[model samples]
Target: MKSSFLKKHFTFVFFIVFLLFSFKASAQKVRPIKSDQGEVVTMHSDILKEDRRILIYAPKDSANSEKKYPVIYVLDADNHFAQMVEYSKYLSRQDVFVIPPLIVVGITNTDRNRDLTPSHSNVDYFGKSDTTANSPYKNSGGNEHFFQFIQKELMPYVSSNYKTQPYRIFAGHSFGALTTINCLINYPDMFDAYIAVSPSFWWDQKFLLKLADKKLKAGSTLSKTLFFSDGNEDSSSPGSPFHTDVLKFDSLLKKRNIKGLDFEYMTYPAESHMTVPIKSYYDGLRFIYHQWQLPPVSDEKLNPEIVMKHYKGLSQKFGYLILPDEAYFNDLAQWLVKKPATLNNGIKLLEMNTVNYPSSSRAFTALGAAYVVKGEKQNAIASYKKASELNPTSNEIKSRLKELQK
Candidate 1:
């Protein structure tokens, strides 16, 4: 009987150990990706007085032998890092591109409340004070320390490790969002863009709100892009101030008569605190980089050498299926024509368009025009003939051919 009992007990112990090990392994493992431009790296920071974990996501090209990208520093990295990285990649895809491809630096938190809050205050939501034996506010404010970690430790590490631009963005939600807002109100020059999704306006009974009222005086030049938002979780009843806090903040800024402040506010009627980041992050990114749709000017010209260097990779990335739309290609052609002694580059751009849009008569015509400018009459005549054949009804094509022949 004793021998039988020992065998059964040993089996049970083995199963328990197996279960525990499985759980531990699952907790430590990061999510798997088929293709990724970023990885989760741990940083042992003596500055924050603790070992910190950071998730760094970059453009796919950023990892290639030679490339660089701008970086966005995100708060609450543990919860939202992968999602933001995926969003950045998909949105900045060649077709859906609304913003420049960017790197994401997600900063994981040790003490979320402590590091996110600006001031150590005991004030509660009811407009009363907390004087308990174990008040949560005991470690309420550590924004300065958190900023130190980012500025002293994180920034240097990223700059030294990655090729980054002077432009950077700070993004967060809830308490994390409050931290971003605090940075903007107090240290406006800290970042290029500030994305605060539903910051806790209830914090210390509108501490940051009051600060904005005071600091953003009439016609103050706060040259920055700020995008903030709230969600429907605050919608308990009609005409309630619960969800109107962001609106109130928006109005306050308008009333402040602040100049050089490019800002936009959005309210999600269906999103709650936890879910707002999914949509808000994508939208905020687009809002900040809306200049992408503007026409490419002479100064905005793509360097031929740089274009040639990255062209093959870029073509492969877009699956070598580029289409020359009238709007986009025309702009590129105008940019190319402005540079003297770059007819070869101009011809190259036109050829790219022809390959993408083989059916486009305008593409051939543009190619012909560039050849004519280079005194290549034979090539120009061939292109003009093709253009006339493709678009036989166009009187403009006939006029061009007649003029070129003379």
Candidate 2:
């Protein structure tokens, strides 16, 4: 009886081992999902003497092979990186058509109080200083060094590694907003645009407001875009100094009439300080790209030349060679191809896209479709062949080419 029991136990153990091995093999066969949103990059900052983690989000468009995107550098990335990424992705969609695709560079903070504040004051928000060892503002007043870290270390790294345009935007909130204003006043040429949400203007007894009044001279040619906002911090009280300070800043800008300085001010009475970033960011983006929307092109006046001229104007404004988005142009071409009056224009636009995005299989395939619609059999076949060569794995292109050839 004992020998028989031991034999059964050994058999059970052998079965368990086999099951474990099978499970291991099955786990190895599974593949991980690949993310194209962006990646986390770590770099050592010589200016700050610390390793910084930057979050980058680039648009996933193969047709933008030769195109460069504008970069937005945001502070306090840990709290707002994902929001900014989502905003850029959604607004820049071909259908939404609100803004252009942007490269969001989120600079994660190592020390928020130290890196974000402009002045090294131990005084708290209530105008009282805590001299205790546990005080959070001990390492404050590092903004100068932080800006150096960005200008000298971080910007160079991003410019070298990413497909970036000459135009750049600086964005921040609360204390970060104060830092942004400081940069604007001291280093005005650092960024082409600025977004400051709920700036803590009360910091160090409204130091920044005084500085802005002194620095931004009347009729000065600033040639920059600024979007700033304040939240419902005063509880609807007319005497709320927080809101008053922002108003003062706004009044100063208006009085100065600084030439070339395109500025907008907004007050969010419904949103608190923490909840204000979302709406402010959306409005800020719209204001900055107010001139980006293409004019209405009806079926009667579907002109590729009009589109080209608009983009050329945009290119000059942005100080870079900007072209119409490939997907936008392709969708326009497809729509135009259906109308006999606009069919020729559609074909011309597709041809232009193929030239602008030479390596894009989608562009070539789109051109081929337009040719097919025009009954240009030879041109259609040639375009499809080139597309198939560019994207060897595209069975759809191969199938279409075979049908055309036959």
Candidate 3:
């Protein structure tokens, strides 16, 4: 009895120790929630001089010594931080190849109006300036000071603390939109891309608009990309000003002879000021990085017989119900015919994609192409026929089979 009691006591002691360690671990400081892919992480930055919060998102692979990432600074981070974080991570995935992975710096706000507007003026949404003592304009017109914080404090802190490249993007909306455009005009070299989503052109009786007119050098080579947009809420009340100010700015940009200044303006009539960011942000990112795509395949690489098989597998992977686009099929065909040595490994890669996406007919088509190059013409014909059956309307596959028959 004595021995049994001692044994039970030892077991109880072990349980107590485990509980203590688990409790200690649970009590550790909280951090930002990790992104879905586990490659993205966010953390709060204590670099703002004002009573504001900031968040930074970096790719997990950013830790590699040789890898460098472009930085994107977003305004009103409290609202759009998560969406932008996921977009950056997924669009830059190894399989996507749309754009390079990027570091995202999201700056939250304390005094949004004071930091975003250009000049100090107490004017209501109407053209009449407000002269009242208690007007909200009392705390307005602090954008220049805020820009200094970004230049002197935030940028330096981020560059020091993270692995970053020289390329940078500045993004904002509404009042924040005005802030980005103002930065582009006043401090031209701060960022490579300036994204202004629905800027408040009515601020200070259009003080910034007038500043833009005087500021933007028409003949100079600014060498930057700028994208801005607006939603459908065209309310022109005294409090809710609505005059197509974005349109005016768009026209001005069009008339400018500024060399190397790439710009785009979008109007989402279906989306509102609140909802446009979701769509516009994705489109804007794609647009800015459009030139970063992989090189296209040449005619020598495009073997129709080999490409047809690959298309079958891809269709199965994407879902047997859907088929590969003409461009995608054409590129793969070119690669298979032009580079037979690459076919062996590339075929295996397509097989993995097919396994992951079992319904993709494109994967099967690719597999057939590899077999054909290996002197398995019959297998190639089978693959081409399967691709044609899966996607009956595919003219490329049909033509390929007819040539082989002849």
Winning model by lDDT: 2
Per-residue lDDT for 56 in model 3?
Answer: 83
lDDT at residue 88 of model 2 (Cα atoms):
91
Model 1 over residues 163-204: C-alpha lDDT tens digits? 776678999999898899899988877787899998888887
Predictions ranked by lDDT, top down? Answer: 2, 1, 3
**Candidate 3 lDDT over residue span 35-122, tens digit each:** 4432222333344343546788877642124445789998998887777888898888755756667788888777787888888878
Q: Judged by lDDT against the true structure, how good is candidate 2?
A: 0.89
> What is candidate 2's CA lDDT for residue 71?
95
Give the range where candidate 3 is weakest over 10 consecutive residues by summed lDDT. 318-327
lDDT values, one for every candidate: 0.77, 0.89, 0.72
What is the per-residue lDDT of model 2 for residues 1-406, given as tens digits with 9 covering 90 to 100?
9999999999999999999999998888667876555789999988888899999987766655656789999998988888888889889988888789899999998999999888877788667887778888888888999999999988998999888889999999999889988998898889999999989888877888988988999988898899999899787555658888889999999999999889999999899888999999889899999889998777667666887899999888878888878899899889989998989988988998888778889999999999999999999999999999999999999999999999
- What would you estimate as the lDDT of candidate 3? 0.72
TM-score of candidate 2 to 2 decimals: 0.86
> Candidate 2 or 3, higher lDDT?
2
